[model samples]
Target chain A: MATEHAHVEEHTHPGPRQYVIIGAILAVITLIEFGVFYLEMDAALMTWIILVLSSSKFLLVVGYFMHLKFDDVRFSGLFFAPFVIMVSIGVVLMALFFNLTR
Target chain B: MQYLSGIDDHRTSTGLDNRKMLMWAFLGSDVMFFGTLIGTHLIYRNRSLSGPQEEILSIPITTISTFVLLMSSLAMVLALAAIQRGNMGSFRFWTAIVCVFGSIFIGFQMFEFAEFAHLGLTPRTNLFGSTFLVMTGFHGTHVAVGILWLWTILFASYKGKIHQGNSLQVEIAGLYWHFVDIVWIVIFGVVYLIGAYGAEGRALEEVHHAARAAGIG
Candidate 1:
């Protein structure tokens, strides 16, 4: 048990400074999202841009804040498998339901 | 033994804390659950042929709420860090702030829901109302549960039940709180932002093509 814990602690977690930096980045991305929301561009283009930006926020939170980036790889495998599967399912559902076209 | 670290001292076959592993697995399954709900909302988004559609959504207010939730995640991590460092004072302060922030986000949702209701939109109003209310309503419920969970942890710390020696408690709560925040990230972008775009008569040509393909246009 001691050895296991030592291994877990071997990965250096982010300090408060890193967390504050991450929070600021998240806020900035959100502000950009707000700005992008009003941009007079193609709806599809804005959607993709927002999706990319939001995905970045999601990854940052999961990686740094949640400590997944520094934690055991097994945890990442467990979370990402279902996450990928569900995202794929969402896309397929959208395609089928919307009959998506160019 | 480094008991002060947040990692549990328990031995597991997977060499990871069982409780944390269980939480991750549960979160993975939750991803599918919410995926279905969000997908439902998107599928039915443009199908509402009634008044009080997505255009009635107040993006500015929702944006403020999103920012609050995001900050709460920050506070949650800070709380976890404090507990790990045996800084009980800082832990309690950050934890309390997290609860407050979570409550504010819920308050925003309640206001938004009431405003939508006043505008003649309810679950029974149209497909949009049903899917939108159900999706975001569930997300709001999760946030409420997270608030309650953090409050319980705060109260427990007062009882000496939580400390650096057992900071795993705070870590678990932080995990749940962060999950809730991430879910909102997806909701804010996909549902509110994109849905609003579609509702403003600026929907993608594919939307019209889809509508025509289905003979709804």
Candidate 2:
């Protein structure tokens, strides 16, 4: 629902350049994620790396490709709140699984 | 009501949009479901209940599938653009393309799951099985649902429910499709690539830890 500037914008969409940038960033994030497998770190850092990378890609795709940026900001909230809660539950479930396994 | 400002693209009736809003909320809750499921997968991944486990995720195979899904998103969005421009022909063309791409992705997943099951990894087996099957299985279900939605739209389009003026319908469907793709992006990194690359995950983790140790994180 983002309004254009009275018929003077370059493109209706965010322009192809933005998509390219998004793609490049995603590729970099993917590389970083895969890159983590080689290091000798404790469990906490390993988890943190993946979490940050995943969250970044998630935000970018939803905000850009989904046009949540152009659409209502409420849509972003709708998408985000669940995401955070789900991630919290994800953390709890993983921890619970660990405890149960032990 | 004031919140309607952004999404008000001149729909005669928001009946569908309201329904979509509700469905999105439900899907939001399902987010928690997948999160828990993936969490379980990660937890048991290190434990390795003694079998061909995450080792068989096949980064190359999943990478191909991921590419397919990503392209499907592009197609779906293009379909929306077509519809918005009031070109029914192009809309139908692109929506059909979107459906095909989505189906291929789902079929590949089925094949992968079958392969894993054949290799003795399953929810019935152990903890790894539980998390792996549940998380990916839910994702597969979502894909199936998206396909069903696409096919329905296709049928409706042929029957006249989806038209050039109704690009928003396609947009909503595209939104769901993209959400599914986004989820896979994470799953790709966490489950497939990390599970596959083997060394980068630790390396990146160590780098982060070093940063945090240096108070940079």
Question: Candidate 2: TM of chain A?
Answer: 0.70
Backbone Cα, N, C clashes tallied per candidate: 0, 14
Compute the lDDT of residue B120 as modeled in candidate 1. Answer: 95
Tens-digit per-residue lDDT, B57-121, candidate 1: 88899999999999999999999888877799999999999999999999999999999999999
Q: What is the CA-based DockQ of model 2?
A: 0.35
Segments of candidate 1 deviating more than 4 angstroms: A1-11, A100-102, B1-9, B202-217
Residue-wise C-alpha lDDT for candidate 1, range A1-102, written one tens digit per residue: 554454457338988889999999999999999999988888889999999999999999999999999998999998999999999988888888677632
Candidate DockQ values, in order, are: 0.65, 0.35
Model 2 C-alpha lDDT per residue in residues A1-102, reported as the tens digit of each score: 323331222244564456556756766666676567556676567767787878898888887778877765555677689888877777777778778878
Q: Candidate 2, residues B31-141: lDDT per residue as tens digits? A: 777777777677667565345555567765676787777777767776776666667787788788878988999899889889888988877776766778788888989
**Clashing residue pairs for model 1:** none
- On the 0 to 100 scale, the lDDT of residue B56 in model 1 is 86
Of the candidates shown, which would achieve the greatest TM-score relative to the real structure? 1
Q: Each model: TM-score of chain B?
A: 0.89, 0.79
Candidate 2 — which residues are off by over 4 angstroms? A1-53, A92-102, B1-17, B196-217
**Angstrom error at residue B2, model 1:** 12
